[model samples]
Target: MSETYHIPVLRDACLEGLNIRPDGTYVDVTFGGGGHSKALLERLDNKGRLYAFDQDAAAAEQAQKLATYPQFQFIQANFRYIGKFLRLHGVRQVDGILADLGVSSHQFDTAERGFSIRADAPLDMRMDTAAPLTAAEVLRTYSEAELHRILGMYGEVRNAKTLANALVRARQQAPIATVAQLKAVLEKHAPKHREFKYFAQVFQALRIVVNEEMGVLEEFLGQCASLIRPGGRLVVLSYHSLEDRPVKNLIQKGVLFGEPEKDVYGNFYKPFEALHRKPIEADETELAANPRARSAKLRVAVRTEDGVR
Candidate 1:
């Protein structure tokens, strides 16, 4: 595994949550750097199989190293199509699924990928390079209203309206094709002592929109609910509330949006049982070593054999 690709957060917690059976099939939906996948494989015996998914070319290149392991198979595709891909591979259900939702550390460290605020790279934040829309395209083509909505909803940017207007106004004179260009435009509106945080939020908003992260996450979670067998586990590690909220709701309530329906007896039906009432966070030891783990929230659930309410 490439040390720079990504460091799995809450490794032990996630493994414990999965409760792996020695010979059961498992899937690591976000196989960045294969850290989690490697660990999962270590726990599985010869009869066990591990399927890993990734869309980024860089991650795919890195995954080739794991190919020598007979128990391992790598699928180069976005996890949003996990169900389709699994069915194509002759898999109907899995014993466990693990998703580490952080954009890989390597993606941020490689300046040209444009996932970092500290870099001066071209505004391209597509996790899947083949994807049609890039961050530059989103900024250039999206309307002021669209920009504002994404910034507000995805990034929680405080002055999304002002920032959106500023971006539109700046683009009128010249294209905002690079991080440096976008930073300059936002500098004028950034609050005192909060410029870094503001830039981070803006970039996050653009990346989310360009990647359609929220929609993809919803689809993946929906598939997880259906594809995990009874007593199987669904383990997710989300780096932001935008991602964590849906995972938490879907696992506990069986619905991605709105409240879960209740029976005449006033009891709500749950498809999975939450293993941990509160999300597991990185310990101080891990946090000190990996600052990225600070924002991570790990949630786990086990599929149940209950009837509808």
Candidate 2:
């Protein structure tokens, strides 16, 4: 893997959370740069197995570098289907599963990916190049209300409704097909001096909707409880609150939404228990080396016996 593909965030903390066993089976659902997968493989023995999943073709290409490792295998698909793919590989359960969510550094830095506000590229922020939806399509076809919801819910943009209306009006005049075109519309409404942050928020909203990230994450997490053996770990590194919330809920409440239901005995049922009350943040040392690590929040959970059912 190219060193610049991505720098794994909270690497040591994630490894420690996994508490790897040499002969155990493990999975890295977002094997972006294969940095975490490569590290996991190094700690495993011949009997151990590692299954990695990545929807991005670029990441799949990066996976080639680790193809020599007999213990490692890569699945070029979104992790929403993690259970289906793992079962096809004869893996019904694993000792640990690591999910590093959100866009990778390579995706953001690549000018053509349209993930970064810093560059002017086609509005194609599809994490999987093969995916049908693109940011451009979302902007061009989505209703103003649909746009408002995503902008507010996914990106937490303050003027989502206003912006959504503006987008609809602007697209009527001409298609907002590129980052530059979209930014031209955004510049009109963006708060002075905070234009960059505002642009990033809007981009994040569009990217999430285009990729169906939150929905995919919920599906993937739903499978995790059943796919991890009792005592196994689930380590997730989420970059934003939208990604972190479900992980927190699943670990704490054993459900994606709402509070955990109480059993007949009046005790709440939970599949996994959080290893820490608070999400772990990158240390000063790591932040100094990789500024991208600043927003990362690592959460680890252990599957309880209840998860096996």
Candidate 3:
């Protein structure tokens, strides 16, 4: 695991949530630089199998280092296809699944990837470089209304409508082909003291759309309900509310969008039980070391027998 690639947020808490058994099988659905996977491998016995997934080409290089472990298998694919990939490996059920969602530090630090507000690069923010849709394409193709919705919902930008209008107007004059152009066009609208923060939100919104993060998260969480054993655990670390909200609802209420409907007994028909009443955040020490951990929210859920039935 490359320390510079990404530091696993809430590592101790995530491992505790897993309640790892010496011989149990587990999956790390977002391998990134294999930080969490390597940590999991340390806790597992020789018989305990660990499967990891990542679609990024760069992550494939990191995955190769973990190939030395006999109990480890690395699948180069998006975690949304976790069930199919695991089934292909003859793993029908796993004791635990861990997903550290959102973009990795390596992705942001790489200038060519265009995932950072601080970097001036091509408007391409695909987690999988092989992915077809680029941020440039989204900016050029999406309607004003589409931009408004994504900026508001995914980025939580304060003036999404104004920003959307500004983007549309700027693109009409000349294509917004780079991060520098984007920042230049929207600079006037940014708050006087927090220009970089505003740019960060805009870039985040673009990255989410380019990566299809929300849709993939919904698909992955649905599979977790069925793939985990009755007593198994599902631990997720998400970077924003857009990702965390659905995870919370799915774990607590078994529904993606809202409160689950209750039966006459007033018990909600849910697949898993939330291990924590509220999402966990990183400690002050961790926050001081890695400011990125400040936005991270960790949630743990235990699959129930009722879900399997």
Q: List the residue pairs that clash in candidate 2.
A: none
Model 3 quality (TM-score) = 0.96
lDDT per residue for candidate 2 within 125-210, as digits (tens), equals: 99999889999999999999999999999889999999999999999999999999999999999999999989989998998888
Measured against the true structure, the TM-scores of the candidates, in listed sequence, are: 0.97, 0.97, 0.96
Q: Report lDDT per candidate.
A: 0.90, 0.92, 0.91
Predicted candidate 2: what Cα RMSD to the true structure? Answer: 1.4
| TM-score-better candidate, 1 vs 3 | 1
* Candidate 3 per-residue lDDT over residues 23-95, each given as its tens digit: 9999999999888889889988899999999999999899999888888999999999999999999999999
Off by over 4 Å in 3: 264-266, 307-309
The lDDT, on a scale of 0 to 1, for candidate 1 is: 0.90
Model 1 residue 201 CA deviation in Å: 0.7
Q: Tell me how many clashing residue pairs each candidate has.
A: 0, 0, 0
Q: CA shift at 249, candidate 3, in angstroms? A: 0.6
